[model samples]
Target chain A: MSLSDQELKHLARLARIHVEENELNALKDQLGRVFKLIDALQAVDTKGIEPLSHSLSLSQPLREDKVTEIDSRESYQAIAPQVEKGLYIVPKVIE
Target chain B: MDISSLSVKKIKQLIDSKALSAFELAGLYLQRIEKLNPELNAFITVDADKTLAQAKQLDQAIWQGESRPLMGVPLAHKDIFCAKGWLTTCGSKMLANFVAPYDAHVVEAFNRSGTITLGKTNMDEFAMGSSNETSYFGAVKNPWNLGKVPGGSSGGSAAAVAARLAPLATATDTGGSIRQPAALCGVSGLKPTYGNVSRYGMIAYASSLDQGGLMAVSAEDIAYGMNSLVGHDERDSTSVKRAEEDFTSQLNNPLKGLRIGLPEEFFKEGVDTDVAQAVEQAIQELEKLGAVRVPLKLPNTSLSVPVYYVLAPAEASSNLSRFDGVRYGHRTKDYRNLIELYEKTRAEGFGAEVKRRILTGTYVLSRGYYDAYYLQAQRVRRLILQDYLNAFEHCDVILGPSTPSVAFGFNEKTSDPVSMYLSDIFTISVNLAGLPGLSIPVGFGREHLPVGLQLIGPHFAEAKLLNVAHQYQLVSDWHQQLPAGIAQV
Candidate 1:
């Protein structure tokens, strides 16, 4: 199963990665080999088996509705690339 | 004195008897790291002043008559875990400058038990590669052979423990990361049941399959480390809430009448001849100690590598989406729009293997292929788990070679992705089944590198798995053998 250049670009866009033009052939080749391994799963007859999402059956534990965390905006924002007035500064998506 | 060969238990005894001060012990390990780490590339970060300060505080507490279980013991935290006031790089350029404001649950628990932090060990970038070659910091070399690659993404942790840079180190396994590296570097490693250890603040790889575990010189040392490492954390909902267990409590359990399952598929053609022979010899030793071997078949075991690639990548694609350069980690300095910011930051941040997984993950979970790839892999995952459920009914524990072959030289399998993925074939099924698995040095394989024997148990049976491994270590000297030239360090 070989991935076309158009399909490879679509995957990179969906994954939010910038794939260089030179890197495209190598990436396509690597993915082709990986897909060959993954394609083996298609042959297995899993007609009635339940898809196991997690290995153990665990329910999300509930906590009381009270606020549990102390405010640490300053500590958290200190590591952000761009922050102003305790708010993260991202590129203007609205504009 | 040459305390590098001492186990965690012996270190604690020396500290308790006042023969060694906590501050002095910290200095001894720091000097070793200074001398050997330059060549081994084992440690990514080592903070001498902070480590000595913590050691000094522990000495004061001990002087004031306070007691701690693992007092003054030095440990290395894998770079994937978030250690407060330390750079938690996760071996990726994205997190290269990220200083964690909080400690991971494992780090917190270890710190509370009075284990002084030696540093964060290097790892495969985002714990993705089978060999340590993917690390941005540089590949960690196997202590046994300088030209060979240490199995990864916990390669640095395994190498550190093997070189005796630190007596014990913490590592995580998403698909045999801990076990493979431990096997190649000649140490004991335990990957607990999926929910047995808390994942809070542990950098996500594949959430369902990723689990935090330990690495040390001996199985008995691992038991001592486990006493301080396991606990339920409300922070991680998947952290199993259970009664406290003293993992060291059962080390003396005899192997008399023990049922060890030897799966027919594990000993078949793919495994190297030497690895299989060493594991077979180790199992024979167990039989001599009164263990009965039961032959069994996990027919679906062959499909584990394919199933893991699909499921793990799917989960990782979703988990790693958080690294978009907005709140924390590396951000692009040159970007015009929001979308370009995400793409370019990640493009520069992640290495080839991580990007490969992210892209593969995106493809499988995408609109048209989701049902064919993701769902099918999950369904097959159940069949794999069911195989283990049936096998355990006939045997108390399953034994096999931890890896197909001993550690390979660098670039040997890195050029081909599938070949690298197949090296983890023997160990991935346990993660899929959420069972506890252990890798202990049984003997040497080809090239005179270490071969590890894996013991798999039912869910939350870490105590049993460690007990089984301890029984072997009691009769074997493989775990005690150090890298030839490093013994004098």
Candidate 2:
């Protein structure tokens, strides 16, 4: 399965990445090889086979709803590359 | 006393005997870290003051007659685990600055046991690559041969233990991050059954397959760490609620009458003859211990690489989406809009391999192709898991080479990600099956690089796996072999 430059760009956008013009051709080629490898799964007969999302057959264990808060804002914010007013600050999201 | 060289069992013994204070042990390891970590590049962060403070508190508690299993044992955690007041980067610039507000369940467990936190070890960025080359931090050099790559995503932890920077360290494996590196570095590592250890505080790579594990110089030390870390946690919905078994208790158990499965696919071509020879010798040693080798089949083995690439990356793409630069982590300073900010930040923050995976994952998980790729991969995943179940029906355990070859030189497979991914070919199937797998040093390969033999057991069969590895270690001197420079330091 060959990947078009447009599809590659779409995937890059969905993944929040920017592909350079020079790298696009290489990525397209690499993605094609990977997709070709993935094509082997097409031959497997999965009729009536349940998709295995997790290894365990067990159901999710529910916990009782409770309100709790632990304060580590000072500790957590200490590691941020940038922080302001006890909040993690990013480049201004609003123009 | 070079505390870093001591096994976890010996460290505990000294603590219990009151011969060495926890503070003193922590100080020894800190000094060792000061001495060797620069050369090895095994640790991302080393909080000597904080670790010593924790050690002093444990010492005071011991003076008051308070007892704990891992009290004062100096151990480091992989950067993937969130430790309060410590940066948990998961070796990715995406979360490079994210200090966890709360401890991961494994971190909390170690804290509760009063274990001294030496620091955070390095790893591949977001656990994506086989070699530590993909780390946001510079790649960790294998202590044995400085030019070679340390087996990775858990490369730092493995190298730390190998270099004697820390006695034991925590790691996580989605595929072979723990075992493969541990093998290459000639240390022992165990990837417990999925959900065997809580993943609450671990930075997610692949939710279903990622498991917290340990890498140490010996199987006994891995067992000791596992004993404290493995248990059900309410915070982790997937944590299993099984009776806590003492992993070290079976260390001395006889392997007589045990049936070990040797899968034919594992011994096929593409396996390094040196690695196959070492594993074969290890198997022979186990045979001398009265264990019988039985041929087993996992006919769908080749599918693991393709299946894991689809599923793990799919989960990773979703898991990594949380690092949008808005909450925490790297953000672009010059962007006209939020969308552009997200794009540039992610592009800048993530390494090449990580970006590749996210793109592959998003492509497969996209709207129109979901069934053709994601759903089909999931079905193939089940078939792979079933192969393990069927093998277990006839054998007690499975043995194989943890990696196809020993540690390759730096930049060896960097350009070829496909071949690098195949390095974990033997190890990924166990993750897919959710089975417990352990890698034990068997012998050295070319250039005296270490080779490891993998032992896989049924789900929640850590005790048995440890037993098999420990029994093998008794007769073989492989685990006793240390990298040359470590002893001098």
Report, for every candidate in turn, its global Cα lDDT versus the true structure: 0.94, 0.88
Looking at candidate 2, what is the lDDT of residue B442? 93
Show pairs that collide, candidate 2.
Answer: B104-B201
**What would the per-residue lDDT of candidate 1 be over residues B176-237, giving only the tens digit for each residue?**
99999999999999999999889999999999999999999998999999988898999988
- Identify the CAPRI category of the predicted complex in candidate 2: medium
Write candidate 2's Cα lDDT for B28-145 as tens digits.
8888889888988999999888898898889999999999988888888999998987888989877776777788898999999879999999999998888899998889999998
- Give the residue spans of candidate 2 off by over 4 A: A71-95
Compute each candidate's TM-score over C-alphas. 0.99, 0.96
Binned by DockQ into CAPRI classes (incorrect, acceptable, medium, high), candidate 1 is: high
Scored by TM against the true chain B, the candidates give: 0.99, 0.98
TM-score of chain B of 1: 0.99
Error in Å for residue A95 of model 2: 9.7
Q: lDDT for model 2, on a 0 to 1 scale?
A: 0.88
Off by over 4 Å in 1: none
